[model samples]
Target: MTVRGAGIFGLACAHACATRGARVRVIDRAGIAAGASGGVVGALAPHTPDAWNAKTAFQLVALLEAEAYWAGVDARSGISSGYARLGRLQPVADDRALSLARAREASAAGLWQGRAEWRVVRAKAGWGPVSPTGWLIHDTLSARIAPRAACHSLAGAIRDLGGEIVIGEGAEAGAVIDATGHDGLAALAADTGRPAGTGVKGQAAVFGLDRRDAPQVFADGVHIVPHADGTVAVGSTSETEFADPTATDALLDDVIARAVAYCPELAGAPVLARWAGVRPRARSRAPMLGPWPGRPGRYIANGGFKIGLAMAPACAGLLADLVLEGRDAIPEAFRVEASL
Candidate 1:
């Protein structure tokens, strides 16, 4: 089936579909990664302990699937977007939050069991040094991706596989997979009557820090991810239902301050760029991935929100499985019928 809206998810879906022996045509309103997927950093952190059941499961499956997908990309395409498995560090500022973090870690042990990539690290014991107040939850499953490079590489892979990509606003396709993040969903809803998904605006910045100064990935309240270009990405601000895609002064200032606080080397680092984009946030944090409820031959694959980058491969794989191979189960948490 031909796929429309060749953003990360769309491109991924097209790739998976073609690999499964389907003729795929990917269409996009703008060039690839022209939306939220173009952001500087794509942190692949799974949900913290506070995440609900469905969201957490969705994140876990996505992380696992992405690891394999990225490894394949690294071998085949040799496009490395600074992908790394550096674990996440959550710092605590208050006593209450500390207690909550500990409890969440305990609870996650059961939920994350059999998932060998995640573990709880005691202070000063495992992996890296832990924070004094907060417990270090080490998730080897987590990864980082250069958003733009991953998108470009995925699109290139799809083309190399003999799939066609048409760049324009209105293009024809056998089936339209609306993976255009937040900005492209409204028009998709208008074209097909699926409820318009909401948007969550996020702001981020890139700093040209010395590579020797920072780890591949680190996170406290904010995340700092190292890129291949001797730079690190720091972000991000979350706003519900916001429209503006330009990074605000307050947000940029806050990210910079946080980056400097996390790693002093960034104190005088030169700012490379600042950007903001809206992720498609569904009513449920889980992605909407299935044939549009009422629209024939049209599918919805947006609403991945903050975790879009982490979840893209798994989500696309499941969608392809359903669309091309007639599979019924699609990562229990991300199944569209569950939300419906």
Candidate 2:
């Protein structure tokens, strides 16, 4: 099978197909993790535990199995994806938010299938966010993976599995999977003469801090993810309109300030890197997966949006099922037709 784009979606799908004994080839004009997947922050955070549905359920399954999936990639590749399931912490801004959080504890208990817990706890110092309400919601389901490293790890695994990765261009052979991300979305929009999907620009910064063992923090819509490589990443600003998708500006400065404000311990950390990228967001605001409507032997795996890294493993599996085994296991909400 041939997969287009070397971002998390394409690489993971290529790896999945190889695992299933399918010879695979991946073509990416830009090298691995050359887009959103190359960004600084990698937060495998879960959706709110309340109001559980197929989408959230799908993410849950992915988050729960992420450790094993990434570990296999790491083992096969002999490269660490920097994956860690250290969970996440979110500050409660007020009584109302706290009430909702506590309520979700009940829902998460049942909805999460006892595999994880969502509970409110007294906010603690050091490795935590500032909470005016003195409370925080901590859930065990959230995890982190180094975005670039994960893609490289998967590439190595694919190579180990005897799959081919063609940079720049390659002839299309066998079933074709278009995980081309933003470009694919743009093509879809042009094809339908409607906004099927578009790029959402995001910016983030990395800090030189060894908080690898700490749970990630989500405060005031900002994510502070601590990777296994001793660096902490904090970001980002979701801008639907931007002059330059790859340019980082003052918006990132604000996020760094907010991250430091949320976790005071990061006040003096060295500014390691600032990065910007565009993510593919479908019109349905969910994963866009399925065959091209009128194009046989072609499949799509895009629309991961803010959750691409988090959702890649499970979404890749579902796409591989359809492409390699002729099985359709994708949820309707995540289908390409949904975007159409």
Candidate 3:
């Protein structure tokens, strides 16, 4: 099968196809991770308690499967993308927040496999060493990936497997996987009759800080992820319906201020770089995967929103299983037909 668009989802599909004994060719207009996947830090945390049952189930399986997949990739070939299971911390800002956290803790414990790994802590007096005035739920299941590096590694793996990756504009293929992200469906003309997904712009900055200065990872409204190169990645702002992929001063200020507030060590960090990308967010907040309703041989695995990196491995596996092995059992939430 010929796969077009060698982004995260496309490359993942290509890898899966090659593994499943299918001849594959991946084509992309721009380089890998050129869309939302190009961001500095890609968090692999799945849904919270707010997600629906089907969505939660899919993410749970996907997250677990991705752990094994990344381990395999790391062992067979070195992955320099700084993949770390640093866990996640959802702080309780207030009393209402604390209640919500408690509920989430209960729900997540019941749903997640490693229940004992999650803990809820109380806040202390001072903010320095003291915790917030809420609960701290630390789940070991969450992970992080250096987006660009992972994308490069995946592309390299696709080539290493003897699959072809064509980089040019307006390339053609027998079957195309629209993993180009926010730009993907638009590039494809949306002839498949599926509801066009919405775009959300996110801006983030990479800061060069001492290794000891930054935390492994801290996420609230904004997230801070430390890289192996003594650089801490801080982001991101969610702007709905924004098409421009350029960084803005307002976003930078907000993120920096928030990052320093969350982690005081980064108060005076040197800014390295700043950029932005548009994420394809599905209207129903679920990914669309499978062939175009009426257009045969064309498939879409885009609209992963902010969790594309965490969700790609499983999504790709499912898509390949459907296309190659004639599997019909897709997670009900991710069924493209429902959205169509």
Residue by residue across 101-157, what tens digits does model 3's lDDT show? 778777777778553245567533332212367455566677777888877777777
C-alpha RMSD of candidate 2: 0.9
User: TM-score of each candidate?
Assistant: 0.85, 0.98, 0.89
Q: Residue 57's C-alpha lDDT in candidate 3?
A: 80
Q: In candidate 2, how many Å is residue 130 off? A: 0.8
Model 3 vs. true fold: TM: 0.89
Candidate 1 vs candidate 3: the lDDT winner is: 3
Q: Which structure among the candidates has the greatest lDDT? A: 2
- Regarding TM-score, does 1 or 2 come out ahead? 2
Give the clashing residue pairs of candidate 1, or none. none
Estimate the overall C-alpha local distance difference test score of candidate 1: 0.70
Distance from true position, residue 335, model 3, in Å? 2.5
Clashing pairs in 2: none
lDDT of 2 at 13: 95
Question: Model 2's lDDT to the true fold?
Answer: 0.92
